[model samples]
Target: MQVFTQDDVLRFIYNEVDAKEKKSIEDALRLNPSLLTLYTELKEVVAKLGNAKMEPDNSTIDLIMAHSAASKMETSH
Candidate 1:
């Protein structure tokens, strides 16, 4: 009867747990409503994060390129 923590649930969500721990968590999830709710919420968050897009804007990219070109010119001289 191991009490799973939020960290344990997170590892389970990411498939970082071993087979035995995975089975235990699955069993707990079936019998414990609270754990199941946590799992569901965390899983949704993980899914949303997976779908999230993050990239530098065009201005940031242009700034980086400009800096790189300036550095290259300084070195070549």
Candidate 2:
């Protein structure tokens, strides 16, 4: 039996694991309470990340652009 580590869990969550490894993890998830909990938590996090918008809103973008323009003006003078 291969020992699953954090990296393996992450890979499984991301669908980066090979078919055999994925099957192994899926099997473990059924029998191991702790692994199931970890998988559930990771799935939630991944779902949240999928819905997350990291880009700054228009107002913030405007503020940053204005600040950048101001800095350029100060440096050129």
Candidate 3:
């Protein structure tokens, strides 16, 4: 079995990769216990972060929108 890459971890999280790849990641994790634990811990932290609510800054949002619009126009041209 080959060593797993960070991309595999991301794909495992998102379920975007094939079963063969998923199984490969699992097999790699079986050999590297630390990675397996890190994966589980980080996923739990991310889940909690997602569940936690935070207020968005209106000014920051407007600035981001303006910048995105400007970038889009530049790209389209």
**Cα lDDT tens digits for candidate 2, 1-77:** 66788778889999999999999998988888888898899899889889767776899989999999999999999
| Candidate 2: clashing pairs of residues | none
Residue-level lDDT tens digits of model 3 in 13-40: 7788798888888887888987788778
Listed per model in order, the count of residue pairs whose N, CA or C atoms clash below 3 Å is 0, 0, 0
**Candidate 1 segments exceeding 4 Å error:** 53-77
lDDT of 2: 0.89
Model 1, range 1-77, lDDT digits (tens) per residue? Answer: 88999899999999999999999999999998999999999999889998778898999999999999999999999
Predicted structure 2, TM vs. truth: 0.63
Ranked by TM-score, the better of candidates 1 and 2 is: 1
In model 1, how large is the Cα lDDT of residue 70? 100
Arrange candidates, best TM-score first.
Answer: 1, 2, 3
Candidate 1: worst 10 consecutive residues by lDDT? 45-54
Model 1 has an lDDT value of 0.95
lDDT of each: 0.95, 0.89, 0.82
